[model samples]
Target: MSDREPEVVRRLSSYDVTRLDTAITVIQTRDPALARILKAERDVLRDHRNQLDAFATRMKFGSAAPWHPEGVMDWLIAQGWAPPKGLLMAEGEQEGQVDR
Candidate 1:
C-alpha cells in the first residue's frame, strides 16, 4: 500500500467546507440523483431534529437531561465536538443552559 494514502479526517475547516460545498452545489444543480439524495437527507434531518438532539443529549448527559430542542450541534458541542461556528452563547457564558 502507498504510504501517502489519505488518513482519517477529524474535521474540516470552513475553507475546506466551502470548497466541497461549492462543488456539491454545482453538481447538485446539474445532477438530479445527487440533488435528490441531498434533499432527502435534509428532509430527514429536519423531520428528526428533535429526536437527534434528544439522542445526542442522552449520549452526553444520560437520561436525566431534559429533552429540549437545543439543536443537534448544541448537544454535540457539550460533548467536546463543536462545529466551526461554535455555540451561540453570550459573552462570558461558561456553560450550556442544559448542562445545569
Candidate 2:
C-alpha cells in the first residue's frame, strides 16, 4: 500500500468540489481539472445539496456578501482571467436605445 492515507484524498476531493461549485456559481467556468472532478461527482453533489441546506445557505451568503461574485471575478481578472462582460451589464428592464 502507498504511504499516503485515504483521508487525505477525501479532504482534497472535498476542497476541489467546493472550489468547482464556487467557480460555476460565480465565474460560470470551471478549471479543467475541477470540471472533470465535478462531472464525476455531479450526481452525488446534487443529492447532497438537495438533502441538506448547507450548500444552498452558503450560496445565499456568497451572493449577498460584499466580497463575492464581483470580488472573485475581479481577483481572477487580476490573476489573468478575462473579465466577463455580463458582469458589467445592468439588470432589470432596459431604458433608451443607442442609434448606430
Model 1, residue 78: distance off in Å is: 6.9
Measured by TM-score, the strongest candidate is 1
Candidate 1 C-alpha lDDT tens digits along 1-100: 5757447522233454355456567778689788667666555544455455556556666545455335544666775665565546666776545544
- Output the TM-score of candidate 1: 0.27
**C-alpha lDDT of all candidate models, in order:** 0.57, 0.56
TM-score of 2: 0.23
Please give the RMSD of candidate 1 to the true structure: 15.0
Collision pairs in model 2: none
- Residue 27 of model 2: what lDDT? 41
Quote the lDDT for 68 in model 1: 39
Error of 1 at 22 (Å): 0.4
Per-structure clash totals for the candidates: 0, 0
